[model samples]
Target chain A: MTTAQPLIQARGLVKRFSGFTAVNAIDVAVRAGEAFGFLGPNGAGKSSTMRMIGCVSPPSGGELRILGMDPVRDGPAIRARLGVCPQLDTLDPELTVRENLITYARYFGIPRRVARLRAAELLDFVQLSERADSKVEPLSGGMKRRLTIARALVNEPEIVLLDEPTTGLDPQARHLVWERLFQLKQQGVTLVLTTHYMDEAEQLCDRLVVMDGGRIVAEGSPRVLIEQHSTREVVELRFAGESQEPFVSKLEQLGERVEVLPDRILLYVPDGDAAVVEVTALGLHPLNVLVRRSGLEDVFLHLTGRTLID
Target chain B: MTQLAARRARPGPARVPALAVLQYHLVGYRRTWRGGALSSFLLPTLTVLGFGVGVGAYIDQGVDGVSYLEWIVGGLLASTALQVAIAESTWPVYSSLQWTKIYFAQHAAPLRVADIVAGQLAFVLLRVLTSAAVFLLVTGVLGALRSPWAVLALPVAALLGLAVAAPTFAYAATASSDSWLALLFRFAVIPMTLFAGVFFPVESLPVGLRWLAYATPLWHAVDLSRAATLGTAPVWSVTGHLLYLAAWAAGGWLLAHRALRRRLVV
Candidate 1:
């Protein structure tokens, strides 16, 4: 092992359930203090890959390591140092919010006195100190997610795995979860998360792998991936008198690439204003025009041939 | 050798888990006290009053020559023990697996599947033992105890409860849906209660149905308790009955562990 070896490493990791393959020979490596993300659509094997890294599910065949130890052989020891927030909320409803933290700490063999102090601190860190005595069932979605995060941190884990940390929450709830995750990232905790939301991946992940059909299609920093796959600017034009098809051929020569949507046409050009002026000179009467910088969503669409939301 | 030494340095399996499971039982017992206490006390109480007092007023004590109240008290204790075991083992176990997700929460920690099963069985056995103790005390207050041999009935009832609870827990863990549990209560528990000689002697039933009584754990428990309480020996050896219950408990525990390990670990 090298001195700069990654905290987590998997080589040709394959996980299959019966005849169905969930993760098909994927290789991944995550270093310390780096926020990594797995961006994919549903059933794209993101959660399965996270579970294997969390040491909860054994890989069907792979060379997997966590904290420089084998996951299959040293799961308990590796789990002791790693925190996992699963895709679903598995908080104990029977326990109070504080008790949930303490009970989880106990699972890692943390002493009761230390666990209590840690629970109090973590509750405060999650901004849930006011509701520490409340049962988990009555808490809102955001509070439950925060408590799950707090529970994962009880052992002072070196690496925290969050699977779709803000999938179903409202905007406010998602922002709160994102802010807390940002703080963890600032504290130098190695965060590995999976999210289908491109904005979430861009905001939270320093490096990410876009997965589809049980394989990694692209991997890099969000900005690097976007720059590599998509142009800097895109111009959108909608026609009034004719369908978008007629304008696609007319606009194709003005930009490096032209993509036709059902209602609008996109011209991916180095300069948005020049593309818009060139489009207006074509004598095509358009209903609307828009120019914006390219984003991770555009990169995802370009690679996957489908929008993230669709 | 180093690994063995490290293993030995850790606490015994029985110590920390016993405390955790004990705490879990206390919480569960508090939650279900209203329903659990009523069912445990009411069924035996009603049977003693309805059959032992009401029906006993009409007929003389038969071949065994024990008072009707005294005779039925042993059966009541035995059946109550079985009921407590069945209640703890079936729906609660199923709910823990499916709805409550309590077992998953527990297993996420240092607690192994064996710890969970052991804790659950231990809690159920404790509940049955406590209920049996209370029932036996009430039976004594009602002057149902004919001899000191009645004292042996408490442990016997607990063992009988384990005999039923252990295997039932194994079955409950393997069930993927709640409908199977409904069937168990409907076809198994209800029929066993009615025909297991709880309210009356099984010998009075037709020979064809008598075999069904013999098949039930409660019947063997009741026969053993009745023999102990009335000082009349049973047809089967007490060792045989104890061994039969032990076999069921052991087999059930093994099966439950296997099923739970397969489900949770994979």
Candidate 2:
């Protein structure tokens, strides 16, 4: 097969559940060996779109092609080549950690001997070799998540789909998972992940689409998106005795645009220090001040008027 | 793309492996031994001991020329086999469809839904045959088999059980929930057991009730088993009884295959 064709392509995709539209018309194309991400808030149709690409749920309308084949007509055949890690771990609780990988490999028609060898290698890769024989019910949450990722790789799939890979984890566990994902990326495996964390998107994805209300409001690399939707630096200000209403009028001349949040007001400017000096010259007594570089969180909040963390 | 299409098109007759279905039934049997085996053996033993000795002193051996103990033994063997087949076919089949998801696991492979239903029926057939063997041996100790033909009745009784169980499995697979199946057992199984001549002769019923016995699958099973044991069936030949059971088995199997394919594959 030629490398010119993309591994996944969707044109004007639409998905509906009952009478409610979950995912409206959207376009997406993912090429081979590229790390892509779907960045959105909760209930933003990220998982629904991932399910369509995974060939588990049929689309309501529009065209979807996976591995250059139709997703609906060739679901089983397409699923054989793609791996899926759902938001919730669906690992067989009755089986041991090693058996989980072996059984999943068998479902993809892998031979028994190869399945056993692959299970052993994946257990070591996920750093669970010593706990291979233990049942899944006794494992910690992080261990179960790692095992789910291991099961997804058992068939040696060309593309792996992960839905909210690190939604619920401590900092240490999240870093451990990110390190393993980086290793997979270095091996030239294509990855598609959905995450609400702006840092996760900035750290992992080469390019992404910011979705809100079932539509892609913006699409670009993290750096490109920040440059397009926001200034390079942002200055935050909190008033001590005065309301932000007077400061919003006084700080109008300092930056390109001003965003008034409930607690503090943000000044979008090319240089945060220059904006802070101009704000102090206006005879404003602020309780707290912070200057930092802009990120995807700023871009997300600017386009959708909704904070990603909330 | 064209090359991959050609690779998928090169196919002969698709066959599901037999061992996968064998593993499925073994897993099920390991989970529910009392429902499948223990009750099948114990229920008939209790009936034999309870009725054969407790009530045998009051009822006299009639002009048919067989003792009361011998007369009731064939009916008990047939009832035991039927009960085992019914239990395996109904709730277990419903659970596999809705709760356990074992069929989904099997169907994700090369195995089709039809292969699953066939494998389940085959497993139930084996269980019924084993239960029939044990019951027949107990009846033999009780001296219920007066002729050499009673030995051949083992396979006959098993085929009779399959006749009833296969159709019941077809009905069970179409059930939507557990409550629906509870209704089926309450309304269908209990009534069939009482009126199907399992405990007494169908002639003892009134004329209207006698016609109801003619439509039941178990009545034919009991009649054939009793005829084999005591040589008392005066109307239907052995060939006739065998043909009737064969019709229900074949028809029910086809219906089950179609129903399961429609519900699962899409």
Docking quality band of candidate 2, CAPRI definitions: incorrect
* Candidate 1 structure, TM-score to reference: 0.89
Model 1 C-alpha lDDT per residue in residues B36-62, reported as the tens digit of each score: 777666666777788788887776854
Angstrom error at residue A72, model 2 = 2.4
Candidate 2 off by > 4 Å: A236-253, A258-266, A283-288, A306-310, B1-266
Per-candidate TM equals 0.89, 0.74
Worst 10 residues of 2 chain B by lDDT: B6-15
What's the TM-score of candidate 1 when only chain A is evaluated?
Answer: 0.93
Model 1: residue B243 alpha-carbon error in angstroms = 1.9
Best-fitting candidate, scored by DockQ: 1
lDDT string, candidate 2, A180-233, tens digits: 888998999999999999999998998999998788889988999999999999
Best-matching candidate per TM-score = 1
- Clashing residue pairs, candidate 2? none
Q: What is the lDDT of every predicted structure here?
A: 0.81, 0.77
lDDT of 1 by residue, A110-174 (tens): 65666777889899999999999888889998899999899888877888989898978999999
Candidate 2, position B162, lDDT: 78
Cα displacement (angstroms), candidate 1, residue A303, comes to 1.9
